[model samples]
Target chain A: MNGILLAMILALLIPIYEAWQDEDIWQKMLAFASIATKTSIMILVVSVLRDDWMIGLVGVLILSVGNAALMLLAHIIRRLNEA
Target chain B: MLENLDVVAIAALLPLTACMLVTQVDPYHALIIRGILGAVAALVYALFGAADVALTEALVGTMLSITLYAIAVRSSMSLRLGTLATAAPNLDAAVPSALGQQLFPALRQAIKKHHLRLEVLPYASPQALQFALENKEIHAVCVPAEQLATTQGTDDVAAPYLLNVRIPRLYETLAAALPPELVAVSFSRALRLTSAAPPPPDSQLQNALEG
Candidate 1:
């Protein structure tokens, strides 16, 4: 269980590194979305380990709503660029 | 065997490595990498028995973000510019100081100010330009100021700005951005002005009719 948790922690590092390296606005936004998803997944994993549905609920909410809003924002920005 | 920590560690490592490599790629490829990152994360969540989280990641992170990024990339602003061939000297030159040189800065200003994607094309003669305009091949045309003067009595010559009638709003935007001395003439008037010249041999319409 500890090893699985450690792996989850390590998994979170990728998006951080990607956001740091990428310069384009779209790529950066994508990296942030990745980070958000990973973080929510980590939350869910931790909640499952503790058998706490409350934290898991939070994770599910983030997973469902967070990236959708972010992508919508991206679309708006893209339309602005087109205009 | 499936519960072994080593297996889980390896699974997580694969995705982590993929995410790291994603940052090294160009923007276009980076988009794909980002999708992969989301998928791998979802897979990791599933392995850890976080089914809800995994499903969310797959839908939002992989599908939604990728679609949005694709739309953003696709929606980049584009403008097509047609110029008299002789007016546009060798653009390949290290420092081109031709008649079209002055226009470049204006175009650049418009792009930088509005984040526009512009393409510059050249026409061999006025007739070819007219044909191209009629076929909706270009958005705007730039002829030499002198050419406009010589074509006097034909129609109003805007000296540099002749916009397509299809996009009246573009005329306002371009007129405001371009030099004041440059006037904006309608497509029909511009066509009539150029009609004084003979037609070119190589156009899609002509090619189809001849062939």
Candidate 2:
């Protein structure tokens, strides 16, 4: 669980790191999105750390739904490619 | 419809678009389509109530279509689609190191200290930098030590400033709003980088000779 949380935070930083290095349009977009998601994760982490069970539960639920959608999108793309 | 275009931009784009539609459908071809769409879209935005969507759809549609078409072509050519897709932003362990951030402030400081007349453009690249210099828009570039050698005048012109700097993280550049890659190379009315005349004699050396 802690490892998963760490992975999420790292994901946010990678873009910020990339944005700093690259001046390309695509690189910048990736960076902005990274910062936004990182900020969101911080809020979620703080809520969990505070033992606010309600908010933490909501955060988890949202994350799960988002992750599921991403997986679903990947599957759809794969099928599209095959078709 | 029939509004708001320089004859030049239109002329450049028309044949370019027609050629792409008829022949090689590459990413650059999409760029021509995008410019055409953007111009058309801007007109539609001005004409009707849906200005924002019109603006977005015009630009987005052109760019996305170009990208999608390009991707499809690449796929047909057996190139992987994974390269086309951008990953979602994730912020798991971003500590925000200052190394990446300092390049901008260091540039600003150089400009300020030198009293240089330079303005970094939006979306400027090294090639653009060389072109601007070639056209005499600006005189000098304050870039990384590595970039100095790439200047057009290494054979004739002597670059006086090759500033090495470490800067602080000034903003959340993750937004890409900052023109970080855009470094200005400037010159006074006096120190032209591409001057046809021979360089002025060194002031200290001249004074010593006279003395």
Candidate 3:
């Protein structure tokens, strides 16, 4: 279980590095989406490991709602490029 | 000690992401990084047996705050430039005048360096254009000197076009970026004073140029 969690952490670093190094706004947004999803999944996994229903519920809510913020941001940025 | 190594590693990521957020130069990019930071923070809070904090961080910190901030930054970090309807025709139309062709691109390039977007608005007459500038409806006004000279019955206008900028910082940026040969850029003091004094309709451009 610890190894699985550690590997997931390593995977999370990939997008964080991409977000930092990439200059393009869209690319940074892509990295953000990846990071947001990955972190929420990690939370779910931790909750399962500890058998904590409350943390698991929070993880589910974040997974569903966090991407809504990403969609809103992307729409605004798309309109920005148009004007 | 070794049993909690994974928690220690996850907690360490919090500071690493925070550093990345601070080092960002662009506001838009920084906002995206901020979302990323919030995600990581929620994960950390959940790991520490704080489910409520994690839920709040995800709902309010990551979702609501980032959306609001993005909208605010997009609208505020822009330059509203007013020009004659005849000169621009429409916001997206290709400007036919030689000065428009050269000046617009230069202005876009100059303001782009400061991470500001350029928005062009067309007004029917010079009076309306000047009115917009005085009322603080727009940041700057661009007019053909020939048109103003024809209206005023004087050919003393030296430059091909005139650019009146109301904001001092914007005036400095435009003055530095634009060539004098392309257009005459001047700071307008009408915006600085109280709105009680109405601008004289006919010589508003001249007044803007002089004071």
Candidates' TM-scores?
Answer: 0.46, 0.20, 0.86
Chain B TM-score against the true chain B, candidate 3: 0.80
User: By the TM-score metric, which is better: model 2 or model 3?
Assistant: 3
Best-performing candidate as measured by TM-score: 3
Give all candidate RMSDs, comma-separated.
Answer: 12.6, 22.6, 6.7
Clashing pairs in 3: none
Specify the highest-lDDT model's number.
3
Q: Which ten residues in a row have the lowest lDDT in candidate 1 chain B?
A: B195-204
Candidate 1 lDDT at A32 equals 66
What interface RMSD do all candidates show, one decimal each?
9.2, 16.0, 0.7
Query: Can you rank all candidates by lDDT, best first?
Result: 3, 1, 2
TM-score of chain B of each: 0.50, 0.23, 0.80
Judge candidate 1 at residue B201 and give its lDDT: 18
Candidate 2: docking tier? incorrect
Model 2 ranges off by over 4 Å: A53-83, B1-211
Choose 1 or 3, whichever is better by lDDT: 3
Q: What ranking of all candidate models by DockQ puts the best one first?
A: 3, 1, 2
Model 3 agreement with the true structure over B1-211: per-residue lDDT tens digits? 5888889889999999999999998999999999999999999999999999999998899889999999999989999998765444464452335545788888899899899999988776667766788889999987665444333332335666677799999999989998888778878744221113233323666877899
lDDT of 3: 0.84
Tens-place lDDT digits, model 2, residues B124-205: 3445544554555543334332244344333323333332111212112111232333322332222222212222224434
All candidates in order of TM-score, best leading: 3, 1, 2
